[model samples]
Target: MIPLKDNIPSRRFPLVTLTLIIINTLVWLFERSLGPSMENLIFAFGVTPADLFQYGLVSQLFFMTTAMFMHGGWMHFLGNMLYLWIFGDNVEDRMGKFRFLIFYLITGYIATLAHVLSDPTSTSPLIGASGAIAGVLGGYFVLFPHAKVLTLIPIFIFIQIIHIPALYFLGFWFLLQIFNQTFQGAQSVAFLAHIGGFAAGALLVKFFQKYRY
Candidate 1:
């Protein structure tokens, strides 16, 4: 199932969400322009647990921030940006632009930390904005459980769009992450980062409920 959109509308302009989308898109384009040379970019910017643990300084700091912009592939970038565009506006509308931006970065950093903790020795560089976008999903799930998500369900070659309850869709997504992370044992993709960002979003929303405005 692919999410095409959602029914929830924001009362205010989600500048932060839009800005983040632009930034991510630009970064992806830049990496794509590099073609085979993108590996060099990933090695420099993408998070590597081994580098963090060994170098333990500026390299780690750069990766912690840069990792959020680096993505493994086209689908990876589109899927994450789609989720952010769908759910991020509502959260940003409630939290205000600045706070929402900060919240996103914090959850993203926490997600990266979770990835590092899981595989501190792996040389594979962790990349993608899903972890951060997962946080937006997490927050939206909490704040608007009843919201409707318009999704495209594919059956063989047939495709149909339907609206599903936010709780059901988001809940299923989260559970799938946990299930995959547990059974796959961290082989491909940082499923644990998704879980961590989701948890962070849920907890952070609780922590600053009053500030949600």
Candidate 2:
């Protein structure tokens, strides 16, 4: 299920969310321009669990943060940005710009750590904003459970648009992550990070919103 939009509208401009999207887009374009050198960039910035554990957290902090802004491919980049565009604004509206930014980064960092812990011996570089965007989805789930998400569901040969409540949509998404993590073993994607980020976001959003109230 791909979320197209949500029923909730932002009371204020989602400046941080748009800025993040622009930055990710520009970074992606720069990565494209690098040609064969893109692999080097991903290795340098992306979080590799083995490298992270060996080097220690203090030294690997930069990579942990940079990894969130990096993406493995066009689909990876676009998919993350799409979810952020759909759900981030409402979360941002609820938490305010600064809090939302901090929330995003914190949840992302936690997500990366979760991935690292899940497979400490793995050597592949972990990159993308899905974990962070998953946090935004988590926040949306708690803050706007009643909001309807316009989603595109492809049923083999047919495409259908459905209005799914935020609660059910996000709940299903989280469950899917758990199911993937349990059955799929190790793959290119970090399903644990998504679970960790969503759990963190759902847990911390209320605390962040307390400042607003």
Candidate 3:
């Protein structure tokens, strides 16, 4: 299911979200410019579990932030940026630009930490902004549970668009992450990080609602 858009109206322009998207895009472009040396770029910026385990906490902290902007490929960046565009405005509306920016970074850092804890011995470099954007989705769903989302459903050669409630879409996604973590044990994506971001967003959104209002 590809989420096209959500129904929530933002009170302010999402400058912070736009800025983050631009920054991520530039960083990705810089990585691509290096061509074959992208391996060093990825290692330098992306989170490595073994490095975190051996080198104490500095590498962990640095990568926790950098990893959010360093995506693996085109599809990875597209999916994450799409979700961020869809849900980030509502969150930025509620939290305002500055606080929302802080919220995003905090949840992202927490999410990366969750990934690191999940596989401390693995050498795979964790990358992408999905965890942070997953947090935005989590917070947005709480605020606008009944909002309709335009989604594209692709079934092999067949494809169609459908409107679905925010709750149904995000709830099913959360459940799928849980199921994956339980059965597959973090093979493909960072399911635990997604869950962590979701939980952090849900809790932090509630905490910041009064400030927003």
Sort order, TM-score high to low: 2, 1, 3
> Which stretches of candidate 1 lie above 4 Å from their native place?
55-59, 208-213
Clash statistics: count for each candidate:
0, 0, 0
TM-score each candidate.
0.93, 0.96, 0.92
Global Cα RMSD, each model: 1.8, 1.3, 1.8
State the lDDT of candidate 1 residue by residue for 136-164, as single tens digits. Answer: 88998899899999999999999989999
Q: At residue 210, what lDDT does model 2 achieve?
A: 39
> CA shift at 78, candidate 3, in angstroms?
0.4
Clashing pairs in 1: none
Q: Roughly what TM-score does model 3 have, to 2 decimal places?
A: 0.92
lDDT-wise, the better of 1 and 2 is 2
| Rank order (by lDDT, best first) | 2, 1, 3
- Could you give candidate 2's per-residue lDDT for residues 56-162 as a string of tens digits? 98898888889888887999998999999999988999888999999999999889889999889989899999888888888888899999999999999999999
Worst 10 residues of 3 by lDDT: 204-213
